[model samples]
Structure formats: structure tokens, C-alpha cells
Target: MGLDTPRPRAAARHPARSSPPRRSLHGLSGPPPAHERTPLIRSCHMTHRSRRQRMHPTNTPSRRADSPIESLWPHRYSGVMISIVIADDHGIVREGLKRLLEVEPEFEVCGEAKNGREVLDAVERSRPDIVVLDITMPHLGGLETLERLRNEYGDTKVILLSVHNDPTFIQSAIGLRADGYVLKDGRAEEIVTAIREVMKGGSYFSPAVAKKIVEQARSPKSKSSDPFTLLSAREREVLRLIADGLSAKEVATELSISTKTVEAHRTSLMRKLDVRKATELVRYALRHGLIEP
Candidate 1:
């Protein structure tokens, strides 16, 4: 159902709960225009000069000893380096990726983050061309983070790195139009290949992930439509807030909209999900992996 569903205006009888600062989907009120919703890519750089220096310790020719001189001179004239941000919860994992990608003179490790929020911040500041992100993180999960990145920062490509190979996770990433999906256990060369493929306007999935997609295509169970496709972006945002235990008034305040508008969105969500109660909505969200249990 559309978010245009209407509900009668009611008086606010309860108070909005105090909540920690979090990202808002539609600025705090009604659905913002498409152009206004996605942030403009301002030219900015991450202030991690010292940290990046620490990541690459040597200044000698031995680092490039194995590379042919012919390959190194082309990038200098082209003035193009594929910028990347590595987002992983583990410091060691980030370090490993940074070092691996740094070996390629054409690739630059521009920034790094430990969680979803930090990832957002890093991307905004660095304006990296690509983001290599872990699938599971605290504060926000990878799937949700991918949605935000696609919506708000449309220019950057995202590659999901995960330990899980479940069909649900694989399908979600594909639906979200992720540029690549690579398993953490895969060989280092796979990541390099994925980066190159995605940069060339192509997509890549790990061998195991590709096999899962093929198996899913052959299975009858894969034909079922995802219920999430039925809800509009605004309705989905309202559902997430409500599932997070926010009251209608609180959701209105958080979204910068009137209570009547929030109520209308809720009504539309209920109608679309075929649920009658707030608890049922929460259950639907949990079942669909919209919110944590």
C-alpha cells in the first residue's frame, strides 16, 4: 500500500520518549523530495593523515620491487586511483584489508571505520569511490547500512564482506543492488577481482555465493515475493521506528512530521501487512528482519 493512506487526526495524549541521536529517514516530517533526500557529494577528505601514514610504514623501492615499471607510469598520467574505505568491527581485519589493497599502487586506502555510524561518517568525509563493509555490525546492521548508503550516497559502490552464506543474506544483498558480495574466508585475490570488476561497471559474488544464487534459482521456494517490496520508503521508515518501540507521537517528532501524518503512515503499514494491532506490526517487522528481536 502507498504511504498516502489517510487516518483521522487525533489529539496527542502521551509524551515522546527521550531517545539517543540516530539517523532519520525522511528528515523529521513528511517524505522529502528525491533530490533533497540524497546528500550531495561535497569534496572532503578524511582527517586521518597520521593514521594512514602508520598503515604504510616503509618508504623504500622494495615495496614496489615486484611491480613492472610500465604498470606504474600509466596511473600517473590518468590521475585516477580507486579510493576505498574498509569498514569492519575488528581492528585486525581492517588492518589486513588496508595492507592488502595498499599493495596495488592504483588502489588507495582512504579511510576506515569500526561500525555503521562510523562508516557513514567516514564515507561523508572521504567521499570514497568504493566501500568494503562487513555485513554485521553494532548500532546498525550491514543490510540497513547498505540501504542508507544507496539512498543517501548514491555515487559510492558497496561490497559486503561476511562470514555467513545464508540464502536470506545473499538475496537481500542482491535486492539492494550491492556491487559485490565476498566471503571473509575467500582468498585475497577474490577481493581484488571484485574491486576491479565493480570498478568496471560489473558485479561480482564469491564462488559460494554464486552457487547459492544458482541453487536458489532452481528451487521453487525462491519464487515467493518479498513482502517488503509492497511498502513505500516512508512506510518502511515508520514501521522501523514503531518496531523500535517508539510511540506515534514520538515517531512524528523524530521524523519532523505531524501526529496525524504519523498515524496515517501507521494505518497504511497495518493495511499492507494485513495486521490489526501494533504488536502484530512489531511481529511482522521481526519476522522480516526489519528490526532486531
Candidate 2:
């Protein structure tokens, strides 16, 4: 005899729809129960609500819904249209900033997110050169988002906007290597200046925040070494230009030096300041008043 064979398991059938073999229609059909009817009706209602999941490319951080069009508003700026990502949880704030930046020739708000969780996705999806985010966003706060950005989105620089200029927040942002900071209540001109400064690869602190930095300079906690003092005036100029957003090639072109020479200056600057990224070197330059604010 063949090895003892086991019968195959029957396929499961839905009790609601499966009819008993040769059963009368009366046994299989009925008016739906109240609970079952509720689900069917509810699902139909849900279908209406889920017709579309539109995204507003320039909607900013507080918009409850998106218009599904990217940059539905054309923007004019003084310089080249530098695409930007602005994040906050407030619609008015986002729209206001976008409108403000759009007035500058060189800036445009390409994407806006309402919270930190949306920052990365917005950055990646939008490919903005700069991400201007609120420091205290929900889901992920500004500091954490900055860290994530540095590690995960290396090329996109971050600018933190907040109402507070607390030393702790600034220090943490600097520690994480933020590219820029501005007060939410700061002047519109200051915000524009910040975008330009950061775009040129320099970090900016608003006037009040700058005062906090100056205070740090006078504090006993100051590091004993002064790196800026070590640089020659010429090297310092090159550093400023580099921080101002000119590539080594552009700086070299402007200064009439070999690209190699510009690279040497950058390398030396980094070494003298004990900083790693180009942005940090720029910050070091700005912090010392080597460059205009």
C-alpha cells in the first residue's frame, strides 16, 4: 500500500458568502445585521474621503491640506532662484516665510513641511539646497532634525528658526554643526540676510543670538586657543570668500591663484581652526568678525 496518505486540508471559505452544499436560499440569504450594514456604509463613506492625497509643494509647515501643485506660486528674487525647504508646524508661518523669501531675487521656497518628521522626506523629495526649519517642531525637534540631516542629508545645510536665543539651544546647534540660525521674530531683512549668508556657506546668528555668542566669547569657558588669530590676513580673506559661498575655483578665479593654492588655504584654515567641514570653518570666520554679518 502506498504510504498512508493524509487528506488535504480544505480551503477556508467565508461564512458570510459561502453557501452550504445544496442548501436552500433561505438558509444562505438574509437581511444584513445592523453591525454588518454599518461597516459597509462606513466603508463607502471612507471611500469618499480618500479620493486623493494631495501635497502642496510650497504649502509651508502649517497647511492642513496641500494644493497638489508644486510651487503653485511663481516667485521672483534678486539673485538666482535658490530652492529652499522650510519646515514648521504653522501654516501662517510657513506661508509668510515663503512669501518673504520669494521677494528676494536669489531665493525661493520649494518645499514646506509642518513638522520635523516631514523634514527629511521633504528634503529628499524636494532636493532643496537649504532646509530652514523651526527649532521646536513636533515629531522630531529642530536639533534632532539637524543631526539627522548632517548624517543623512549631508549636502543640505540647515538653518534653525526659533523665538528663543537660549545659549543651550545655540550651543547644541553649533555642536551638531548647524549652518545657520535666526530668530522667528527677527526682521525680514535679517532673514533674507541669513539665507544669503548660509547659501554662501556661512552660518549666521541674529543680532540677539549674536550677542549671546559674544557673551560666550567673554565667558570663562572660552577655549584657550584662538585659531582665527593664527591665520594671515590674506588667508583670512580667502576664508571669508569661501565662507561667502564661492567655490575654491571661484575664489581662485577671483584671487588669481591656482586652484591648488585655494585648496591649500582651505586646508590650512581647517587645520588652524580645528574644524572639519567647510561650513564650520565659515562659522569660525563669522564668529570672529572676519566676515560681514
Which candidate has the top score in TM-score?
1
lDDT of 1 by residue, 233-252 (tens): 45766888788899989888
- Compared with the true structure, what per-residue lDDT tens digits does model 2 show for residues 1-293? 35788778887784558554542222214543443221111111122123112111233233212332213423212123467888988899999888988776556677889976688888777667688888765445566678778888787778889876667556666777888889978787787788778877688888888887788778845433455545654576677678778898988886667999999988898888788998897787567543445
TM-score versus the correct structure, for each prediction: 0.56, 0.49
**Alpha-carbon error at 233 in model 1, in Å?**
9.9
Best by lDDT: 1
Candidate 1 residue spans exceeding 4 A from truth? 1-79, 223-293
lDDT of 2: 0.67
What 10-residue stretch in candidate 2 is worst by lDDT? Answer: 38-47
